[model samples]
Target: MDALTALHNRVSTGKLTEPAPTEQQRKNIFLAALRAADHACLRPWRFLLVEGEGRERLGGIFLKAAEQAEGAALTEAQRQRTKAMPLRAPLIIVAITRLQEHPKVPHLEQHMSTAGAVQAMLTAAYAEGIGAYWRTGPLAGNPLVAEGLGLANNERIAGFIYCGTPDKAPRQAPDLAVDEFFSYWGAH
Candidate 1:
């Protein structure tokens, strides 16, 4: 698909199935991510690719983290759901931001750069006929999850990007009005 078409039509695919993106598709996705704009060229982002047994292990880590956070209060259904979260897709990319003290760029901008990278990846996935979803919940911010994922103190989870085959055809992108979100501001 054309770049403009991909950018305008990309949408999150929540119902992903087996058969993850092909190696070439992944390359395109990652390359798009690497092109995200960054201040001072900090390159403050890193990613973890989880698939097959790694997804199971990630689910275990999530379960442990959730259990620690909620204790016995967690219902059986919740526990099972937590354990199966990672199984929703065939492959998962854990986006992380490495914080640094830059004279000009703050931590928030660094995180924004990572967000841009993930967005680019999502668009690229859409262009390649792959399903992709970016998700972040309580588990994403839990300290236990950070430790389990071997994230350092300066590294923070940005999102869990799930990629796979869509269960059905992708829905059309909503036609939003540019005027609704854009405006002219010269000397307001």
Candidate 2:
């Protein structure tokens, strides 16, 4: 698909199947992410590609986070479910952001840039006919999870990009009007 088409049609795929991008394809996806607009060239984004046994490791992080939060109240079944989340897709890309002290870029802008990286990755995956989804919850941002992932105190997981072949066709996008969310400033 062309860039414009991909931009308009890229929607989250919740039912991602197995067989995600190969190692080489993942490299290409990361390359696309690096090309996202970086204000002041802060380049504040980092990525952790979880696949194979790495996915299990990520799941363990989630389970550990749950355990730390709930302690004895955390059920064994819930812990198992946390570990199984990674298996839902063939791979998951953990998006991380590095805080900058003297950055000319604002924190919100840097966050948007990281989101733009996610967009780039999703677009690239769409171009390759791959299904992808961005997901996050309490576990993603938990300190225990961060520790399990070996991230610094200043780093955070923006979201997890689950990738695989389409388990089903994507839904058609709803018709949208620019006027609904757009505003003219100086002159229309």
Candidate 3:
């Protein structure tokens, strides 16, 4: 698919299955992320690719972090569900913003750059026929989850991007009015 098509129609695929993106597809997606607009060229971003057994380990981390946050033991069903979260996709990319001290670019801009990078990757995945979803919730910012993932003090989780085959065909993109979202500056 063309870049414009992907940008306009890409939608998140939550029900991903096995057969993760091939190495070539991953290369393409990762390369696209590198092209994200960065202020001052700070490049204050990094990513952790988790797959295979590593995903199960990440599930363990999630289970621990969730329990820690809740301050109580999770029920058996909750424990199983929590540990299975990472198994939802065959590959998971943990986007991290490595804050940098810069006079021109603020930390928030750095985070925004990481977000743009994730969006780029999502677009690339759509172009390659790979299903993708960007997820972030309480576990994303959980201290134990960060520590388990080996993040540094200067690093913060931007999102967790899940990539794999779509369980079903791609759904049609919703048609929304652009006027509702777009506006001209100081226009009537």
Candidate 4:
């Protein structure tokens, strides 16, 4: 698919199955992310690819974090759900933002750069016929999760991108009116 087409039509695929993206597809996706706009060239981002057994390990970490946060209040179903979260997709990419004290660029801009990279990867994945979903919840911000993922004190989780083969056809992108979101800012 063309770049513009992918950018306009990309949609998150929540139901993913086995057969993760091929090596070529992953190369394309990562390359797209590398081209994201960066302020002051402060490349403050890193990614961890987890698949197969690694997903199971991530699920364990998630379960631990959830259990810690909820204590005895969490039911068995909730615990099971937390442990199975990583099994939703065949491959997972954990996006991390490494904040630094830059004279010009602040931490927020660094995060924005990471967000741009993730969006680019999503579009590239769509073009490559790979299912992708960006997910983040309370667990993403949990200190236990951060520590389990071996994140540095200056690094934070941006999101977890699940990628694999779509269990079904991707849903159509919503038709949003540009006029409703954009307007010319000129002398009126």
Candidate 5:
């Protein structure tokens, strides 16, 4: 698929199955992420790829973080669900942003760069016919999660991007009117 087609029609797929992206597909995806626009070329982003037994370890970390945050014990079902979260997709890319002190660039800009990287990865996946979804919730902000991921004090989780084969063909992209979200500024 062409770049424009991927950008215009990319949609998140929640139901991903086995048969994770091939090595070539992953190369395309990661290279696209590296091309994300950045100011001052801080390159504030990093990614953690988890799969197979690694995903199980990540799930364990998630379960620990959730339990710690909840204080009260989680029901068995909830515990199981939390532990299985990472298994939803065959691969999980944990996006992280490492904030750096810059005279002209602020921390927010660094985070934006990471977000752009993630968006590029999503688009690249779409172009490759690979299913992908970016997810973040309370778990993202949990301290235990940060520590478990071995993130430094200055590094923060941007999102967990799950990539795999779609269970079914991708659905149609919604046709949203541009006027609804765009407007003329200082009209001629």
Candidate 6:
């Protein structure tokens, strides 16, 4: 599909099924991510894929975060719920950003670059008939999650991209008027 059509049709696929993408397919996805718009070629993005039994380890990270956040107040049931998040999908891709020392490349720029990479990955998945969803829910920003992903103090987990075969065809997306959001010069 063309870029505009692919973008206009891309929708988050939260409900997925068994059989995650193969290693070769994942490589293709990563290649697409590398082509994302990054000013000065900083390449500040990194990704970690969790699949199969590896997903269990990721769930442990979420559980740990809940434990740390709630301390002794957290109930066992809540802990178990946290542990179930990664199991909801066939695969989870952790997006990370590393800070660079460029004088002109601020931290925000690096973050934008990472986000670009994430969108590129999602678009590539859409193009290849795979379902992908980027989530920055509570677990994604948990400090224990960063530790679990082995991120540096200066690095952070931007989000998790859950990917798998779609359980069903994508639903129609809602449309919004752009002019409602746009501002006119000297209108105020």
Candidate 5: clashing pairs of residues = none
> Please, what are the lDDT tens digits per residue for candidate 1 over residues 37-79?
9999999999999999999999899999999898757899998
RMSD of each: 1.1, 1.6, 1.1, 0.9, 0.8, 2.2
lDDT of 3 at 162: 98
RMSD to the native, candidate 1? Answer: 1.1
Better of 2 and 6 by TM-score: 2
Model 5: lowest-lDDT 10 consecutive positions:
64-73
State the lDDT of candidate 5 residue by residue for 14-71, as single tens digits.
Answer: 9999999999999999999999888999999999999999999999999999998888
Clashes of each: 0, 0, 0, 0, 0, 0
Clashing pairs in 4: none
What TM-score goes with each of the models? 0.98, 0.92, 0.97, 0.98, 0.98, 0.91
Model 4 over residues 7-59: C-alpha lDDT tens digits? 89999999999899999999999999988889888888999999999999999
- For model 2, residues 52-99, the per-residue Cα lDDT tens digits are 998888787777788788874767787788779988899889999887
Evaluate residue 90 in candidate 5 and report its C-alpha lDDT on the 0 to 100 scale. 99
TM-score of 5: 0.98
List residue ranges in candidate 3 displaced over 4 A. none
- lDDT for position 68 in model 2: 80
Checking candidate 2 for backbone clashes, the offending pairs are none
- Better model by lDDT, 2 or 4? 4
Candidate 6 per-residue lDDT over residues 137-177, each given as its tens digit: 77777888888888998898889999999989987767978
